[model samples]
Target: MKKYKGYLIDLDGTMYKGTERIEEAGHFVDYLVRNEIPYLFVTNNSSQTPKQVAKKLNEFQIQASEDRVFTTSQATANYIAQKKDQATVYMIGEEGLREAIQTSGHHLVDENPDFVVVGIDRDISYEKYAKACIAVRNGAAFISTNADIAIPTERGLLPGNGALTSVIAVSTNTAPVFIGKPEKIIVEQALEVLGVAKEDTLMVGDNYDTDIMAGMNCGIDTLLVHTGVTTKELLKQYNSQPTYTIDSLSDYLKHIN
Candidate 1:
């Protein structure tokens, strides 16, 4: 067995589904603590803040601090901060997205913004879409967090960021510049925060399209847990495969030592 010094983990599927946490998810944190390995929960969900994510992890019996959670919201903030010099942004997302952009020293506006940033905003209305479209049409750079089509919920699967992004995509006749998983930006940010090289970091997630593919793209080892969106049957269909596959995180941890 190879020893890993750092981990970039997904939250919704890999650690918990809705309000329920997977058995080995907490145990894996314990193992990391005992062995002194650095770990962070990296999520593509830009709806919630880091504090909200940390609280959710606590409910699942995993002790997580605010700093341990890295969301696409943060990544978007970093992207804007690095590129722009105080620009106004039109936001079509949640409070997390608003906070992230504002905290990065950028202004959030309703009209004539320098950029249009979209995320998962459940209360999104037609007017919001109209505004976003108008802004982008007027030359605002369109930036979106992730393209996840569906989000798993306690009720069932709900519309995700991709669905909203699709509307904007059609309106502007331009694709959004993505900064989440499957793109190198999020994974690269995770590696920088974890301070580990790609070879020594392991990415554990349940989504084949985003999580696993993102890890594979970044040159890190990926483990696919079948408990999420991707199933064993789907693996055969994907051209990109994970380095390892497990029925669940519980089964994967059994071989950790």
Candidate 2:
């Protein structure tokens, strides 16, 4: 196996499932820290900030610092900033997404927005949908954090950002640029944050569709651990598999030298 200089890891499935913690996941992060290997918990979750994510990891007994966490929200803001400076945006999401946009020097407006961005908003309403649709129809740039149709939860499957992002897409018949997993945009931004070369970094996660595909799309190696989402059986259906696969993060511990 190739030695990866840095790692970009997934959060929800790979680290823990909702409020429950993953045992091997904690030790895996411990190994990274001990070896002085750089890694970032790259997440599609746009509801929480870096500090919030790190706190959650700490609760799980995983060692994490704020700088070691990166979210799709930050990627979205960075993307918007790169495209245009101080652009006016109409955003639909939680505190994390709002903070990212505003702190990036973008103006949050209700009318004639230069961009219309959507992330996961559990408290979604019809009015928010209408505004998003109106903004997109007004020739505003549309962006979605992730294309995940569903998110796995302790209760069962729940609607993800993509499902919520559909309203604007269907109404305006305009597709939003997705910045999360399975898209190269988020991975590129994560790599930039990690300060590592694509070839020398490994994308680590449990989901085959989003996490694995994101690495493949970004020309980076990926290691899929069966601690969450994709089971070994389901992974075989994919034509292109991840660079590496293991039953758990514990199985990968020996290879990290």
Which candidate number would show the highest TM-score if scored against the true structure? 2
| Root mean square deviation (Cα) for candidate 2 | 1.2
Best by lDDT: 2
Query: What are the TM-scores, per candidate, against the unseen true structure?
Result: 0.93, 0.97
* lDDT, candidate 2, 1-257, per-residue tens: 78788999998778987788899999899998998999999999998999999998999999999999999999999999999999999999999999889989999999889999999999999999999898899899999999889877777889999999998898889988999988999999999999989889999998998899999999999999988889999998989989999988888987764
Cα lDDT tens digits, model 1, 18-58, are: 76768778887877877888998999989888899899899
TM-score of candidate 1 versus the correct structure, residues matched by position: 0.93
How many angstroms is residue 201 displaced in model 1 relative to the true structure, after the best TM-score fit?
Answer: 1.1
Distance from true location, Cα of 235 in model 1, Å: 1.8
In model 1, the worst 10-residue window by lDDT is 248-257
What are the runs in model 1 whose C-alpha is more than 4 Å off? none
